[model samples]
Structures are given as C-alpha cells and as structure tokens.
Target chain A: MIILIHGLMLIIIGIWAMLTRKNLIRIIIGFAIVDTGINLVLVAIGYIKGKTAPIINDAVSTAQGAAAGMQAVDKVVDPVPSALVLTAIVIGLAVTALMLAYAIRMHKTGRSLNIDDFEEQKW
Target chain B: MIETILTIVLAIISLMAAVYAVLTKKTLNAIIASGIISLLASIMFLLVSAPDVAMTEAAIGSGLTTVVFLYALKHIKDRRSTHDD
Candidate 1:
C-alpha cells in the first residue's frame, strides 16, 4: 500500500510538472519523471516480502538439479516486471533524446525555449 | 520495521525534489533538481532489491540524461550570446 502510494504520487507530480511548466526542457524532465514513476510502480508490484531475488541459488533449494529450479519460484520475487522495466527505461531514454532534439531545433529557429513561442496554429 | 521507515523517508525526499524540479523558475536549477530526483530514485531501487535496474537508472537516467541537458543548455546559451554580439 505504501509502495503503491509512493509510485502514484510521483506520477502525479510528473503530470503536474508537464502541465504547469513552460520551458520545453522542463517538460522533458517531467516526462522522464513519469517514466521513472511508472518503473517504480511496476517494480513495487513485483516485490515479495522476505523473498530473495529470482536467481537460482543454494538458499532457494535447487538441490534436485537444474530441472528442479521450479522449487525456487516460491522463494524469490518476480523477474518479469524487472525485465519489462529495463526495456521501458531504455525506451524512455530514446524518447527523451528525441524530444530534446526537437526542442533544440525549435530553439535554433526561434531563439526561445518557451513552448508558446512555437505556437503558430490556432487548433 | 526499519527498512520501511527508511523507504518512506527516501520516498518523501525524492518526491520533494521532483516537485521542486518542476516548479523552479530557472532551467539550470530545474535540471539539477531533476538529476537529484533520479539519483535518489536509483538509491530507492537498490533498497527494493533491483540492483540491475538501479545501476541502469543511475547510468542512463541520471548520468547521461544530465550530461545531454547540460550540453544543450550550454549550446543555447552560446547561441544567444553570439546572436547578441
């Protein structure tokens, strides 16, 4: 419950940042915050109290050989969420870079970082 | 019991940094605060038993991202200065 709230609160703050901020780079920072918040929430969901990591080890009782690794399942936290977050983090970096590039080009053309300066269309 | 308390404390600190980063007027200050937010978050990830993710976050999120932002900000500043002269 506490973990969930922590993650959700960060997300809310990120959204607020993106909404209230005027600078293009600040908006990008807000986007990164949202990405981090989602990653935290996903990892929080995968945690199991008092359990070890998903690695097969002696403490997890793999004594029956590699084929009996299933026994370790109950003793460790989930790996799926961790893996997913890894991919998601990389994607977020790429997206942030792309956004920054766009901001750079906009600044070059307009001599301003304010998002409102780029507004030409009335839609 | 102790771990829970530590986590709660860390969470509050990071959240505050995030809020400050968003609300700060100066772009440089906002960027630095956001970097601190990522640094603190990586520490929290370590506490949560995700060392791999923590390392990745510290490397890409805090390190590379901040460097890129600094570069871009410097470029913008230089361009504006040259334009004035």
Candidate 2:
C-alpha cells in the first residue's frame, strides 16, 4: 500500500541523513527517523485491507460471546506486527538515549559537536 | 474517499517534516522538526487502525523523545557556556 512505500521512503531519507550529517546529534536524530520508518513498515505490512484493528470489542464480538474469538479472527488485522512495533519503539528509545549519552561524553572530551573535530577515531 | 485524502496529506506532511529535520541547520529546529515527524507518524498509525501503536508513538516518540533531546541540548549548551566563562 501507499503507507508501505512511504515507510520505505522514510527509511531511505533517514539513511541519507545518517550518512551525510556531520553533527553527532543529527546522526542520532537520523537513527530515530530510521527507527520510526521501520516500525511503520512493519505495521503497514501486517495491515489487512478492509479489516479493523485486532481488538475484541463489542464491534468485533457480537451477542454470541462464545463465538467472539472466531468472529474476530476474520474481522481484525494481524496483531503480531503491532505488538512487535510496540517493543521496537521502546528499544528505539533506549538506543537513542544511549547514543545521546555517548554524544554527551564525546562532546565533553572533545569540546566540539562536529564530527570532523575528533580525529582520535579516524583511520 | 475522505480517508484516502487524509492519508495522502499526512504522508506528504510527514515526508516534508523529515526532510526539514535532516536538512535544517539549527539543532533546535531539527529537534523540533523530528518531533513533528513523530507526531505525524502517530496520526498515520491511527489512520492505519493501530491505535495502540499510535498511542505509544505519541507518548514516547513525540513526548518523551522530544523532552530527552531538549534536555540533552540544554545540557550541552549549559556546559559550553560554563566552559566559556
């Protein structure tokens, strides 16, 4: 679908930013964008057209409470991807925090935010 | 019909914000733009019928992430100013 394509485009843009940006914080921002793009792609791929979300609410479950489980099977989109995306979001936040911490340390030692300033790691 | 239009609009805005965040010169502007990207993405998630993901993205991606970035920026700026003085 269009959202899938959009997610791919976002991923490409994020990678471009990550590779081209000179600032450490900007690179981390690029990483966050990439994370969002991946989450979008996963959720989009799991989406079933014309289906509602995977929730067994009154809409999905009719008067027959016993058959509600069966009814929801066909009515809802895949829930696994949504669940995966949730976990991915948390992981992305942790990664971003760790990267920012590293950035802070790097700035502290080097006294510069530019990527070009630190020549110690360059090969 | 309306849903399709909404999706398209959201997608366009999200893309433009992402580009601005990446290309913007000001770190603060880039940070805010990225937050906008996250907010728009949460909206798209709602359009796609993933409310849980949408909620999580709105809370963590747009809210917590922005706060973290701003705090980090403030920390860096404060350190720089102190070092100067």
Candidate 3:
C-alpha cells in the first residue's frame, strides 16, 4: 500500500516534469525529482516485516542463544536495494554535475539558458 | 497503517510541489519548487527506513543541486519571453 502510493507519485512527477518546464534548468530539476522518487520507491521495496539489521554480531548471538540467532539475523531487509541506491546516488551526482557543466557551457557560448534560444544546432 | 498514511501525505506534497515547479513561469521559482519537492521526498525516504537514501536526498537533492542551479541561474540573465525567436 505504501509502496504503491510512493511509486505512483514518482511516476506522475516524472511525467509532469518531462512534459512541462521550458527552461533547461527546470527540466533538469524535474529529472532530479524523478530520480529521487525512483530511489525512494526502490528503498521501500526492500523493507521487510519486523526485520533487524543484517549485521551479525557477538551481542546478537548471545541474546538470541546462538540457535535462532543466525535465522534472526538472516531475516534482515534485502541489502540489494541499499547497495543499488548507493550506486544510484553516485551516478545521480555525476549526471547532475555533468548537466550543470553543460548548462554553464551553453550559457557561455549562446548567452542564454532558455531551451528555445538554442537553434544553432538545428541546422 | 500509519506508514501508509504518511507515505500518501508525502506523495501528495511532492506531487503538488512538482506541479508548481512545472507551472511557474519564472525559472527561479520553478527551481525552488523543485527543491521543495526533493526536500519532501527526502523526508519520505526517512519514513520508509531508508536513512542512507534520506541523507543522499537531503544533501544532493536539496543542498548541492540547489546551490548549483542557483549558481547557474546567477550567471544567466532572465529571459521573460519563452517565445522569442
């Protein structure tokens, strides 16, 4: 239920951002929003029911009496999404930086940031 | 149960901010609106038990990104007319 709402909202925002926003910067921001929404959805998907952290430690082993400790620790939320989100974050940063750099360069060359202003490449 | 409600509320806020970001005529306003959307989304991430994602969203989504956008905005003059040929 929670995942559905978050996922749906993410899709809607991504679509809206892609549709509107004339300025290149706004469009880029929209992309970022879409990126964030997707990340949230991914994290939500990995959440488990009443799970503990995936760490296996001496304290937990002693508390759970060693027999059920292994099973208990194994019930932790899936770490895949967490790993993926970390990668996604780095990628997002790289892309944002590249896009901003491009925006800067475009502004320098054409003296404008409006999407419609750059027609020089059309020909 | 409560988590679902919170998610719905955050989703609504994010969508509203997204709409405002898209609808605003001024570029700077649009950027700020987008920032709000990111900020809300970060909080939503926290509620969902994604502290790592929440931190990233809070830092990159709202912090560095906004600063970069504003810096870029500062370098360029505002072109009021979108239809200028």
> Cα deviation in Å at residue A43, candidate 1?
0.7
Per-prediction tally of clashes: 0, 0, 0
Error of 3 at A114 (Å): 2.3
Computed on alpha carbons, the lDDT of every model, listed in order, comes to: 0.83, 0.91, 0.73
User: Per-model TM-score of chain A alone?
Assistant: 0.91, 0.94, 0.80
Model 3 alpha-carbon drift over 4 Å, by segment: A52-69, B78-85
- lDDT per residue for candidate 2 within B1-78, as digits (tens), equals 888888888889999999998889999998998898899889888878899999999999999999899989998999
For residues B12-59, write the lDDT of model 1, one tens digit per residue.
888889888887789898888878878877887777777778889899
On residues A2-109, what C-alpha lDDT tens digit does candidate 2 reach at each position?
Answer: 788889999999999999999999999999999999999999999888899898898888746668888889899989999999889988998899999999998999
TM-scores of the candidates are: 0.93, 0.96, 0.81
Candidate 1 stretches with Cα past 4 Å from truth are A62-68
- State the lDDT of candidate 1 residue by residue for A1-123, as single tens digits: 466678798899999999988888989889888888888899888888888767676778847766557688778888888888878888888888889998888889988988788778446
lDDT of 2 at A76: 93
For model 2, the docking class works out as: medium
Estimate candidate 1's alpha-carbon lDDT, on a 0 to 1 scale.
Answer: 0.83
